[model samples]
Target chain A: MNFLSRLFGKKNIMTDITIIGTGNMARGLAARAIAGGNSVQILAHGDKAKADALAAEFTGQVSTGVLGDAVTGSIVIPAVYFDAAKEIVARYGDGLDGKVYVDITNPVDFSTFEGLSVPAGSSAAEELQKATGAKVVKAFNTTFAATLGEGQVAGQKLDVLVAGDDEAAVAAVAAFASAAGLTPIVVGPLRRARQLEQTGFLNILLSANEQLPQFQWNSALSFVPAA
Target chain B: MNFLSRLFGKKNIMTDITIIGTGNMARGLAARAIAGGNSVQILAHGDKAKADALAAEFTGQVSTGVLGDAVTGSIVIPAVYFDAAKEIVARYGDGLDGKVYVDITNPVDFSTFEGLSVPAGSSAAEELQKATGAKVVKAFNTTFAATLGEGQVAGQKLDVLVAGDDEAAVAAVAAFASAAGLTPIVVGPLRRARQLEQTGFLNILLSANEQLPQFQWNSALSFVPAA
Candidate 1:
């Protein structure tokens, strides 16, 4: 059951997702993706040991190497920094011609954490989408890495608010989210990624609040229907 | 059921809720407060005609006056711009020795809309509280005026998140919110107003998103409690 099989009218399509980093966010997402029953691979930029450790830790169908190694999957997810996203995509031997690129990094100026690193009107995901000609979709930028790793918060599984213009690609992502034990709330088109980034920034501000400075990373966005 | 009646054992302490400004927000909040059974008043800064029209439109309960009039009974809520919040409060008077001052304005630099206009590491409500010794509490900043006017969306009543150092003050504001037909969500302490302001900013960003632009001012923040 591989991606190729599913694409050819076959019942089995085990979507293989390859993450390009071994950092906290990358490892967290890789673990979740692995837990969701998808084939996961780890690409260590320099530290091969760290990547191998992550692969072993999650019991994932993971492999380790430099970015140029054949990614062997249809959906090659780069779970790294914004600057690294394009670089890693460039490292792939065959460009993402028919792949759905998902950008989750919040290109925020962490030194300030008060504002974004991008221009006044633009966002990180939009920039990355343009940088790599891959069909980029913005998702998983609002939730924290801790919550992403843990999945359940205060016992209730968290919700992932996703937005992207591609309906079919978004459907694939929503399925992936469900596999990760998250309730995926599809908000709107890709540009709404700005909302996700801004909301992520606001959540960061909330985490800095003195009164509730210690807010658990478990909190999430939910839609409560009117009674 | 009046403020004094609920307080000093009089069973007759009338809550004189006066809003300064004849803008849509002021009109909307005043209408909700009046519906909540408070003795509401409207003090027009300069547009007495609009104030009178709104007062007449809602009912005789909301009277109009100049900005400096002493708003007797209950709490005196300052519904104005963050920069103007302090100025309006000063114009109205600083002798708010024992009254609860509800600050619903989010400190947004509308000219930029990139972030807040106030000092970094703080929020509009916090700044207002520091400026006035009127036991300030933050509430209603999370919802749009239109949503507040509508009271609910998709059958779900909207939530008004309140935060303040004073528990009693927060509770009082919560009472007012409940009276207005919205759900009051007490999100920890007053210092959390910083977070509330940030949340408001993010919601504005959501509205600014092109694809789902104006996806109904009906949308609101709903909590997903841990199961």
Candidate 2:
């Protein structure tokens, strides 16, 4: 895409985004997607009440029964667990084909939060790319869920680092991020997920109270010129 | 230590630091420590000639013999290889005791720069802390070695992330970083080394040639207010 096209891609932009998962991050991103001037739908497994509640809260639609409905949108956001992603794709099937699938799950082994659940030398995003055969793009895995709820900070906005081997899919997610009032930092390729996970680890270390007595959770990475 | 002492400890400001590695990172930090007004030294083994050559080019001192002579000052910096640290520590022995030891090395298995050397639950800095009695402090492991040498970019000094259980040691390294014309960001306690290493991994991901194309090697992390 041209620089101007990429920059103003979201201008007067109205797109369809389907959020898969009923968890906090899914809810949060769904709300932001609405705020970003897009149609959003939440898909949860046998949890229509929670989905309905989020829909009511965010003024978006909710899909509790059919996975196909959730994957029908132009941008299908699988904001669910990593292990659950394969099942999600299996259920959604070819409905996800030809759509920009955004995988925002951390895929971290929550029991340890030390290593990844994916096999050594492999990435969860890459696995999802292989499983679904959909255009998979990685984004929204860096920021804290609470930060996503707040979205903008200090009158500026948070940056969403997006990575994917697919150029057109990456561009689509970048537009979605911009529509949500965020600056999308497109990292190199899908393999860059390894680094994205590492960045998340760094942020967690800096923010988590168990690590340091005086460290606050508010600090973030910003780009500036040489001092 | 009191909050103010922890914030800007005066005692460590006067501590002399001798870096024991002559790699790019070692050279970068050595330059900074010298700028910080601390007595800086470089110790290189096997390749003492290369170390000496770098020291001469940078106008610093290089040591090949005894660790005692190299670490006579208040701070001893082990900037060598991950596997080589134990040997260096064994050689240093009593010389490392009662001194603030700064660890700027990442256990990144360069063989597969895509992954870490140590297992998920451990960190190189922590391992150094355990093996050596020299109150260990983890710093300057988050950024690229090139960025470290350059010090600042786009009119802003790069921030050095430091983590360790020892407040005094961390503060000392922070002072050294500041003096070298870089910002010292004390990112919590020692366990946060995991985060810093992960940050390094993220940086690598951003720079991976096959990944996100916009992630230039020169690009780095900086922060500004929410606005």
**Chain B TM-score, one value per candidate, order as shown:** 0.87, 0.81
Task: Compute the lDDT for candidate 1.
Answer: 0.69
A1-227 in candidate 1: lDDT tens per residue?
A: 33454466322333478677787778778878888988776778887788788777877466565566556545567777777786776665246665777788777677866566776445677777666656677787767777788886566567677777778778878888899888776766676676567666656554555555345555555543333
Output the worst ten-in-a-row residue range by lDDT, candidate 2 chain A: A5-14
lDDT tens string, model 2, A138-173?
898876665677775554477788888889999989
Output the lDDT of residue B51, model 2.
59
Q: Please give the distance, in angstroms, between residue B153's alpha carbon in candidate 1 and its true position after superposition.
A: 1.1
In order of listing, the candidates' clash counts read 11, 26
The model with the greatest DockQ is 2
